[model samples]
Target chain A: MSSTEKHIVLAENLTVGYTPKVVSEKIDFQLNQGDLCAIVGVNGVGKSTLLRTLAGLQPKLSGSIQINDSNLESYASSKLAKELSVVLTEQPASKNLTVQELIALGRQPYTNWIGTLNEEDKKQVQESLTSFLLEDLQYSRCHELSDGQLQRVLIARAMAQNTPLILLDEPTTHLDLYHKVQILKLLQELAHRKQKTIMFTTHEIDLAIQLCDKILILDGAENPFGAPCELIEQKHFERLFPAEMVLFDAKTGSFKVNK
Target chain B: MGNLKPYRFSFILIFLVLGLAWLLNISLGSVAIPFKATFSILFGGQVDIESWNYIIWNYRIPKAFTAVLVGGGLSLSGLLMQTLFRNPLAGPFVLGISSGASLGAALLLMGASLITGFASFSFLNDFSLALAASIGSFLVLLVVMIVANRVKDTMALLIIGLMFGSITAAIVSVLAYFSSAENLQRFIFWSFGSVGNLSTQQVILLSIIVCVGVLLSIISIKRLNAFLLGENYAQSLGVSLKKSRLIIIIATGLLAGGITAFAGPIAFIGLAVPHLTRQIFDTMEHRILIPSVFLYGAILMLLCDTIAQLPNSANVLPINAITSLVGAPVVIWLLVRKRKMLF
Candidate 1:
C-alpha cells in the first residue's frame, strides 16, 4: 500500500484473553482508512474478546497494537477517545435517555467540563442524526425505539464520536436478515463516505462477505486476513465448519445446508 | 444539546415555591406567628411583638435552614446514588449510611446507660448525639468505600451496602433490648427524626459539609451524564470509572452521612425527591437534575416540617411520619398517573 493510505489500526502477533487462560492468539491485521472490516468466527471462538482487546476494553495478553501511528498504551484516555470509538453489544444502562441525548454523549471527550455542547459538537450530533435516519426520533426515548432503530441509534452514537476508527462487537446479532443487511450496508456507506476505518465482530459471515472491504476470519489457527474474494478463493470458508453439518458454496458466496 | 430556556420558567416557579414554603414553614410554629410578620422579619424589618421577633430569628429561622440543608443534601446524594448505581430504587440511605448513624446514636443513648447505670449521662444533649452519629456514619462510609474499591460490579456494591445495613440494624436492635426505659425513650425519639435543637455552630458546620458535597456533585456532572450509557461506554467516552465512583461515593457520604448525623436519620425525602423532580423536568441530564432535585427537596422538607408543627399546636408530630405520610402518596399518585418512572 502507498504512504497516503494511512493505517488506522495495526496489530502484530496479538494475543487476547483473560489472565491464566488464552482465548485467541497470533492474530495480525492492518486496516487502512475507509476500510469496512469484519471478524467472523464460530461461537466461543473469542471474536468478542479480540474486538474488546482492540478497543482497549481489556488488556491484551501479548503483542503490540498501534492506532493512528501511536502505540495504543501511549495515548491518554481523552486523547484516545478522539481516535477510536466503540458500539457495545449490551444495552445502555438507562433507556430513559432520548435518542438525541444519547448521541450527544458521543461528544463527551470534546465537551466542556460540565458537558455543554458547543456549536461544533451540536453540528456533529446533527450530522450523525441525519446519517442514521434518526432525525424523526431524536426526541423519542430509547426504550420506545424498536430493536433495529435502537441499533441504528447506537451506531449513530459511535459516528457522532467522530473518531478515525470504530469497533463494534456483534453489531448484527439480534436483527433479522433484512435488518442485518441494512445495518451492514449503513456501516459500509459510513466507512466509505466518511473515510473512517470500521471493524465489527459478527456471525453474519455471508453478509459480511458481501458488504465488507476486508474480512478477518478467526479459525483458532493461522487466522486469515484478506479480501472477501481472496478468502473464498482460498477455500477458508469451506473449512470454517464441519462438512457434515454445512458446506460453503464458493460460486454464489453462501453457505448451504447439507440435506 | 438544546437550550435550557424551556425549563427556565419551571425553575423560576420552583424557586418561588421554595421561598413560599420556607415562609410558611417559619410562620406556622406553636406560637402562631402571622405570615406577614414572618415575611417582614425575614427582610430585616421589625415585627410588633418582641417575643415574636426572638422566636423568628432564634428558633424558626435556624430550623427552616436546617430543613433546607437536610432535604437538599439528602436528595442530591439520592440523585447521585440513583445515577451511580443505575438503579431507580437507590436512595441516600441505601448504602447503610443512616443505619450506621442509627447504630451510633443507639449506642450513645442506650448502650451508655446500660453500662454506666443512666445517672452519669442523664443529660444527653444534641451535641453528643450529633457527634456519635457522625462517627458511626463515617465508620460505615469508610468500610463501604473499601469494599467499593475491591468490588468490580456496581450491583454487588449495592448488595454489600444492604448487608452492611442489615448488620448495623441487628446491632442496634440488640442494644435497644438491653437499655433502660428512659434511655430507650431517648433513642426512640432520636429515630423519629428531627430538624430542630441544633445550635448555631452545628448548623454552620452542617452547612459547610453540605456545601462541599454539593460542590463535588456539581464537578461530577459530566461523568454522571456519561455514566447514563453504563460503565463500558462511559469509559470509552473518556470517563475514569474509579475516579468518578470515588468522588460520587464521597459526595454521598458527606450528604447522607452528614445529614443523618445532624438531623437524626430523617427518612423518605432522600429517596423520593429525585423521582419527584424527574416527574416535572422530563430529562436525565444531571446539570439540570442536581439543582432541580435540591430545590424540590428543600420545598418538600419545608412543607413537611410545616405540617409536622401542626400550626398553632404545641404537640409536634415526628417529621419522619409527616414525610412518609405526605410523600409516599404523591410519589404513588405521580407514578400511577404518568404510567412510568422517568428514571
Candidate 2:
C-alpha cells in the first residue's frame, strides 16, 4: 500500500435502498486514486443501490459519502459533475445522435450555456475517442453501433467529462464473454494509466478478479473490501451466491456451477 | 456526425422553399395580381389597380403574417412537447391547450345566452373571442405547469393534461346544450378556424406572445438536448430538472394558447411539422431541429393557407381542415416509408 496516496472516494456506514425501505447497511469503503474497484454481489443484493448512492443520484438512508474531501450531497450538481461522472446501464432516449455528438455532451458541465464546445473541449473529446479505439465510429450514429461499441462510446463520453472519478452500473451486463472481458480489461487500463478512481458493479467475477485492483464484496456475510487476492483468501465469493446455484473455487477465484 | 453536406443542402432547400411559398402565397388570392404586379407592390412600386393594393397590403399581408407566426408557434410548441415526452406522437394540442381555448370561446359565445342577456357578450365580436380564448388557455397552462413540477414522469403529465381537456370539454358541452341556435352556429363557425380573421392589433399581440415562447425555447435549447438521454442523464449534466420542466411547460403553453386565441384551433400542423422535420433531417439534435422546424413549419402553413384560398373559387376552406387533410397523409406516408419508429 502507498501510505502517501490520497483517497478519492470515502464512504462510511452507508445504508442504501429505495424510499422507506432499507436493503443493506453499515457498508464502509474507501478507494484511492488509480484504484479500480468492483462491487460484486448476487442479483437483488443492492449493488445498484450502493452505486447510485455513491454517484449522488439517490439519497442515502444513513451514512456519509465524501468525494475529494467534499460531502457528496453538499456539492452543487454542476460542481460535482466536474469531479464525478456516471455511466448508467440503460440506453439513451434517442439513437439518432451521432457518436461524436453524444460524446461531445460530456463537456456540458464546462461548456457555455449554448453547449458550444471550445478548442480544448474538442481536443479532449478527440483524445477520448482515439484512446478508446472509437475514432472510426465517431461519425456513426449511436443506433448503428454494436453493443460493445456503444459501451465504449459511453465510457469515452465519461472520460471526456474529465472527472477525477467514474462510476459505471452493470457496465458488462449484456455482453458476450469475450466482449465482457475486453471491456473490463479496457477499464482496468484506463484506471491505471489515467490515475482516475474507477468503480463498477459486475457479475463477471473471474474477469473482475483478474483485472480490478480492489474488490468490494457485498454478501450475506460481512461486507469486505480489500485486494482481490485478500478477498479470495477471505472466501468472499463463497458467500456471494447461493451454494446450491454456484460454488466458489478458492484456488481459481472463479464461480462454477455446483454438481 | 460532423457532416455538413446534408445540413447545408437541407438548410438551403428549406430557405428556398420558404421564399417561393412566400411569393406564391402573396400573389395567389381572389384576384390574380400577376406575378409582376405582386413583385412591384411588394418592392414599393405602385400597381395599376388600386383595389389590388388594398387587397395585398391590408388583407393578404396580415393573413400571410398570421399563417407564418401561428405556424411557427405551433411547430415550436410541438417540438418542445416531443422533447419533453421523448415520444414523437406528443404535440402542443395533445396537452389540451386547444380544448382550453375552445372552452373559453364556448363560455363567451354559448354560455352568455345560457346565463342571462346581461352576461352574454355579443357572440360575433372578435375582441371578446380573443380575450376569452386567451384567458381559458392561459388558465389551463398555469394548471399544467403546476402539475409538471409535481410529476416527474412525462407520461403521467400527459394523462393529467388529457384529463384537464376532458373536464373543460364537458363544461363546454353543457354550455352548448343551453345555447340558442344562432349562438350555436356562431360558436361552430368560430371552431371551424379562420386565418383571415385576425385584425392588425390581434396579430401584433399574437406576435409578442409567440416571441416570448420562442425566447424561452432558445434559452432551454441546451437543456432540451440533454433531455434526449432522459431525465436521469440530464440531471447528471447539472440541469435543474424542476427549472427546466417549468420553463418548457410555460413556453409550450404560451405558444399553443396564444395561437389558438388568435387563429382558433389550427390542427395537425403542430403535431405533424416536427415529425416531418425529423424525417427530412434524420437527426434528433435540438439545436438543429428547433430552427429547422420553425422555418419548415412557416413554409408549410403558407402553402396550406394558399390551398385553402383556391385561386378561382370564393370558397375559403377552414385552415384547420387543410392542415389535417394534408398533414395526416404526409405523416402516414413517412411512417410507412421509414417502416420504423423514429423515436
Candidate 3:
C-alpha cells in the first residue's frame, strides 16, 4: 500500500471457471501498478478465461481476487468498473456509433442514469482520442473503421476509463505487424509513464517477452508467473508449443518452425 | 456548430410532427369533429355537451391516447430488445410474446361461454381474457430470457427467439382450429390489431402499465448503454447482467403484453421506429435514441391509425395490416442495403 509498492491486483489460490466446469485451479498471483504483463498459452489453454476472471467479467470458482486491497467480489460493480477497465475482441454490432461516441461508452459507469457525458468525461474522451492518434477518425462510424483502427478505438475506450488496471484479450489479434508493435509499445509506454497495470493475452510470445515486464505462461499442465527473463532462463518457452511443429530459438529469443 | 445545430433542428422537427399527429388523431376519426371544437372541448370550453362528450371522451381522446401509449411502449420495448440481444431483428414479435398474448386471447374467446356457464363468475367473463394474455406474454418473456441467457452468440439468440415465435404461432393455430365460428371471427378480428378496441378505462390502465415500463427503461438507460457492447462488457462495467436482463424482460413483457392485450398484436412500430430514430439522430447514444424513438413511434402509429381510417372506405383497415404494410418494406430495405454494403 506504500507509494512505491502500488499493488494493483492480487489473486490468491484463484480458480476460474464457468458453472460446473473449472478452467484452471489454485492460482496465486499479484500484479503491481506499472506492470506490463502478457498471458501466453496454446489455444484453449484458459488465458482468456483467466484474464476475464481477474477483470470480474466471469465468476471465480474458489478463492479470492483482490483489486487494490479490497476483495474483488466485495467491490460494487460500478466501483470496480471505475478501478478496472476491460477491452474485448468482440466488435459491437451497432452501426451508427462514431469513434468518439464508442469511446465515450467507457464513461458509462461514471455517467448518470440518463447516460449523458459530462465535461470531464468529454475531456477524457478527447484525451483518449488524441493519445491513440484517432482525431481524424473521431467522427467516423465504427462500421467504417478498419479492424486495426477498431482495435485502437476499443483500446482508447478502455484508456478513457482511466482505470488503474486494464485487461485486454488479444489486443493485437487482427493488427498488421507495424500496428501490432505499435500497440504493444504503446501499452508498455502506458505502464511506464501512466503507471497503469496492463494484462493482455497474446500469441506473439517474442514481442511479449521483449516488451512485457512480467509474463504469465500457461502450458496447460503447469502455469508459471514471473519476470520474462526468469521464465526464459527456466526454459519455459521451449515447452510452450508442440515440440515437433515448432521450436524456441533461444539465441534469437523467438519461435521458429523446424519445418 | 452546424453539426450540433442539426440535432436541435431534428428535435424541433420531431416535436412538430408529434404535435401535428396529435391534432390529426383527435380530429379525424369516424365521427369527424372539427379541430377547433376538439380543442375547445379539451380546454374546458362549453359546447354541444352530447357530441362533445362523445367526441372528446368516447372516441377521439381515448383513441389518440391509445395510439400514443401503444406506439411509444412497443417502440421502447423493441429498442431495449435490440440492445439487450445486440441483434437488429430482435423485437416483441421476434420473442414470441405477442403470439403468446394472441393465443391467450384466442383461448379466452373460444372458451368464454363454457367457462361462464360453469363458473358463474362475472368479472371472469370481462377481465379474465386480458389477465390470461398478460400472463401468457409474461411466460414467453421468461422463456426467451432463459434462452438468451443460455446462448452466447447474439445471432443464435435471434434465431432462438424466432423459433419461439413460431412455436407460439403454432400453438395459436391449434387453438384456432378448435374455436367455434363466432369465436373464430372475434379472435380473428382481435388478431388483426386495432387501437379502437380500447375503452377509456382500458386506455387508462394501459397508460399506467406503459408508463411504468417506460419509467423502468429510463432508469436503466446507463445499464442499457453498457449492454450495447455485450453482456460480458456490461458486467465488467459493473452492471448486474442477470438483474438488468430481468428488469428488461419485465419491462418488455409489461409494454408488449399490455399493448397486445387491448390492441391485439400491433407490429412494426417497435422495430421500425428505433431504426428511424437512430438514422435521424445519427448517434447510438441512448439518451437521444430513447426519446427520439418515443416521439417517432407516437407519430408513426398516429399516421398508421389515420391511414387505417380512410374517409371513403366502408371498413377500417386493421392496424397491424397497415403497420406491416409500412414496416415490412423498411425491414426489407434494411436487409437488402446491409447485404449490399457488406458485400
Of the candidates shown, which would achieve the greatest TM-score relative to the real structure? 1
Tens digit of lDDT per residue, candidate 2, span B236-275?
Answer: 8888887998898889888888788778888888889998
TM-score per candidate, chains pooled: 0.95, 0.93, 0.93
- List clashing residue pairs in candidate 2: none
Clashing pairs in 1: none
Q: For model 1 chain B, give the 10-residue run with minimal summed lDDT.
A: B117-126
Q: Candidate 3, residue A108: CA error in Å?
A: 2.0
**lDDT of model 2 at residue B339?**
73
On residues B1-343, what C-alpha lDDT tens digit does candidate 3 reach at each position? 0024457778898899898998887777666666788787778777775675566677767788889888989999999888887878778887778877876776677656454544334644435667878987888788777877777776777676677678767766776676566767877888888887676678788989999998888888888877777777788777888788889888888988988888888888888888877756766767677788888888999989988987435578898999999998988887786662110
Order of the predicted models by lDDT, top scorer first: 1, 2, 3
- Model 1 chain A weakest 10-residue run by lDDT: A72-81
In the range A1-259, model 3's lDDT, one tens digit per residue, is 2567878888887778898898887677788999999999988878899998888877889998889999988888889989999998777656556888788888887877766777889899999998888999999988888888888898998998899999999999978899999899988988889999999999999999899989988776668889888888889999888879999987778989889
Q: Which stretches of candidate 3 lie over 4 Å from their true place?
A: A1-3, A93-95, B1-6, B32-53, B112-121, B124-126, B312-314, B340-343
Q: Comparing candidate 1 with candidate 2, which one achieves the higher lDDT?
A: 1
| Candidate 3: residue pairs that collide | none
Query: How far is B182's C-alpha from truth in model 1 (Å)?
Result: 3.6
